[model samples]
Target: MIELRNVSKRFADLVVLDGVDFSVRKGETVALLGPSGVGKSVLLKHINGLIHPDKGEVWVDGQNLTRLKRKELARLRSRIGYVFQYGALFDSMTVEDNIKLGITDEASAADETYSRKRALQCLELVNLDPVVAEKYPAELSGGMKKRVGIARAIAGQPTYLLWDEPTSGLDPVNADIIDSLVEKLDDELGVTSVVVTHDVRGAFRVADRIAMLMDGRIRAMGSPAELRASTDAAVQEFLERDLTIPVHH
Candidate 1:
């Protein structure tokens, strides 16, 4: 399980997270929804210890992240795979090599045969052709690049998956494909997942539960239907805005 108890963070005078309490149970997918710059990404970082909280505690699999030593934190992070918003692929590396970088287990990573097999497996899991392994990021389309990023994140067989805007730049069709992939991976792998995104439709489709973050706190959280039925004005407003209703004069 991942738990944040009254977690708070600040950059200079800007408060990003304020007294936030959130959790993701094992083998469940939870979506953290919010508008741009509302600290959704910041909250995700707290899970892996990328950014420390100024207050409260971050617990993952029963370990307190804030108190872990550097090596301990590194070890913990290996069990949690993070997929960045933009794919963050290395321009110079082939898709295979990029995925291989995610293998944190030294002995397994050192074995070329094991690494090769693992990379191919991860590619297949992400619905990418094995032949695409030799291509660089520049050669792949936007959606393909995102898949490669996901493949890299899962190369190490993580117990938890954290996705940051997985469908950010994709068209509606492509976004749906990615959302389906997310659901497929969760069902097949049974890994705990936390998806940070502003796409309400995608979140509703992919997440088992949705948490809305606004104004440095979780405004509301529940199942997709529960969120839709929410009486909170902010929640309703966000949902309406993202649904993109035709504005009539």
Candidate 2:
């Protein structure tokens, strides 16, 4: 389980997360939904210990992230896979090599044969053709690059997956593909996942539960149906503006 209790953070005079409380159950997917710049990404970072909170605790698998040592944190991080907002693929590396870099274990990463197999396996998991392995990032389309990013993230076979705007820069059709991929992954891998996205449609389709962040706090959170029926003014306004009349799966 991943839990954040009254977590708070700030940069100089700007407050990002203020007394935020969040949690993700094991083997479940949760979507952190909010408008851009509402600290959605910041909250995601807290899960992986990329950013430490100023107050409170971040617990993952019963271990406190903020209290862990550097090496301990590194060890814990290997169990978590983080997919960045942008497809942060290395331009100079082949798709196979890029995915190989995600092999967090030193011994496995050094074994050339295993790395190659794992890379191909991850590509297949992301619905990519094996032929794409030899190609560089420049050769693939935006959606393919995003898939490659996810492939790299899952190369290590992490216990938890944290996605930051996985479908951010795609057309509706491609975005739908990624959303479906998310669903497929959940059923196939059963890894705990936290998807940070502003897209309500995609979130509703992929997440088992949705948490809306507003004013540096979780304003509302529940299943898609529960959020849709929310009476909160802010929640209603956001859905009204960001979504069409009826939200369908």
Question: Which one is best on TM-score?
Answer: 2
Per-residue accuracy of model 2 over 1-249 as CA lDDT, tens digit each? 999999999989989999999999999999999999999999999999999999989999999999999999999999999998788999999999999999999999999999999999999999999999999999999999999999998988899999999999899999989998888987798899999999988888888899999989999999988998999998988877767856575
- Report the CA-based lDDT of candidate 2 relative to the real structure: 0.93
Candidate 2 local Cα displacement, residue 246, angstroms: 3.8
lDDT of 1 by residue, 119-179 (tens): 9999999999999999999999999999999999999989999999999989989998999
Worst 10 residues of 1 by lDDT: 240-249
RMSD for all candidates, in order, please.
3.3, 1.2
Lowest-scoring 10 consecutive residues by lDDT in candidate 2? 240-249
Evaluate residue 211 in candidate 2 and report its C-alpha lDDT on the 0 to 100 scale. 98
TM-score of each: 0.96, 0.96
